[model samples]
Target: MQTAAALRHAQRILVITGAGLSADSGLPTYRGVGGLYNGTTVDGLPIEMALSGPMLRRDPALCWKYIAELGKACLGAQPNAAHYAIAQLQRIKPDCWVLTQNVDGYHRAAGSPPERLIEIHGQLSPLFCQSCGAVDPQLSEHLQRPLPPLCKKCQGILRPPVVLFQEMLPERAMETLHEEMAKGFDAVLTIGTTASFPYIHEPVLRARVAGGFTAEINPQRTDHSAAMDVFLGCRALEVMELLISHI
Candidate 1:
């Protein structure tokens, strides 16, 4: 209720989300690509290395072993109520935009407008070839068959558009974020994230400095929580529906 009150008057709003937002849908709250594994994986390598871009290039099979796990988890789960609530907010507020770190594509599935949604960490579907630049839509089918799915046309390794460990963020997504940042937001709401990355925290800081309302919705307190105008200490699934109703 406090978060809604703070944001109710906002015209331009930014809803920044992370893995925690999707965790309610039964997905692991991965810190980047490694949180599912504590320190090292069963393969005796750190989960970061196991899921890194370099590792994918070095041993596609080994890298894809973990990639396939992520794929299966995403495919098995559906978007939760919080996701739909955020989508609804976007519809009601034409200026509302979402910037998410999760690769599950649940926001898109939940009906967030693609033009307004920025998947900062990239997404997990429609695998593409690394070599010949071919696109493959059979992600679920390939996951069932092999470790590293290959391109049908070039026999190249097929991978999702997701940002792997040790990979740069997508340029276009970053550009869109900065562009919007320059225009400024009337309010910024962070949900289910620790605000660990610069990009994640920068928007919140910018909005605050610009005298904009800032709030966070998370089950636990994060480093950014103390500074929020309203910190709803609860899961997005629990509070988002109510927040949307207020908006």
Candidate 2:
């Protein structure tokens, strides 16, 4: 049973999620049991190199392959019980906020109100023209070739609308998050992520600084996991579902 005493004692709640949350829905990653990479997974030459921004720019083909694989993985993915539970948790508290690192759009698809949720990394819903900066509407279509879409204006290649490895978190999203943390959360739950990146890590720390109940749920111990008051090593969605069922 979830001891939601922490939640019960607070009126403000913030939920943060990372890739681990999506992994539970069968999205592939190189970590944990039965993950995609056997030993060392790389994007083009290797998983690490492939994900590097320099590599992405140098070899668009490699980036395309990596992104397309992700697209394929997302094709059959649907919101799991955990995603729904997060939504339910939002409704349980009137002042609830969800900050997600995932670009999968799962949180939005799961019925999380746009006003209450922020995707710091951008959305997986659309591909954008890098040259002209135009974003295409989200639609599922088969890629006949292994290339990113192009800008209709300049014919320059398009890229996933998501923030890339070299990119910084959107300034607007970051500012809003800082302000939200300043407002004082009742409890803060970081699900399936290690706050490795500066932008993603600070808000969770902010919650802790404010004496907000801090927690995390992931399959492995992470840098941020040790700092949490309640750290549960399990699939993010599974833990979320359990928490939602009780509260």
Best by lDDT: 1
Per-residue lDDT for 1-247 in model 1, tens only? 6678767788899999988898999997543344444676778788878889999999999999888888888999999999999999999999999999999999999999999999998998889999998888888999899678988998989999999889999999999999999999999999999857999889989999999999998999999988888888889999899889997
My TM-score estimates for the predictions, one after another, are 0.96, 0.85
Candidate 2 C-alpha lDDT tens digits along 30-110: 233122365444531555555545766787766666666666677668777788888888888878899998877888888
Against the correct fold, how does model 2 do in TM-score? 0.85
Best by TM-score: 1
Give the lDDT of residue 186 in candidate 1: 94
Clashing pairs in 2: 41-47, 42-46, 42-47, 43-46, 43-47
Ten-residue stretch with the least lDDT total in model 1: 29-38
Residue 144 of model 1: what lDDT? Answer: 90
